[model samples]
Target: MSKRIQVTFTKEQWSMIEKFRGILGESDAELIRNIVLIWLSEKSIITTKIKKEMDDENGNRN
Candidate 1:
């Protein structure tokens, strides 16, 4: 099942979101979901790289 979430943003933030939505032709939900998914993927890559670097520094690898 999917969960629903509520997000709060300032007027300026809402304005930007609206502009992007109009330009991209995506609904608010779709835009938010896409942004979050992309952010997660990028974060995961950065985290993996950091962990690998730390492991190498400690001479540990599997």
Candidate 2:
């Protein structure tokens, strides 16, 4: 089950959304959902990289 939500985008964001629609030819909801999933995956990768760097620094500090 899914719920409907509303978003108000700035002009710049609206333009970008239109561009995305042109390339994807998907419904706005589908595009947003896919984008969020991809964004979360990228965030996870960056978080892992940062944790590795912190671990390396801590290992060197001792």
Best by lDDT: 1
- Return the clash pairs for model 1, or none: none
Model 2 regions more than 4 Å off: 22-25, 45-62
Candidate 2 lDDT tens digits, 7-48: 888999868877877455588887776666668767785476
Q: Any residue pairs clashing in model 2, and if so which?
A: none
lDDT for predicted candidate 2 compared with the true structure: 0.73
Model 1 per-residue lDDT tens digits across residues 1-62: 59889999899988877876855458888888776766776778547787788789899985
lDDT of each: 0.78, 0.73
* Candidate 1 vs. true structure, TM-score: 0.56
For each candidate, what TM-score against the reference?
0.56, 0.56
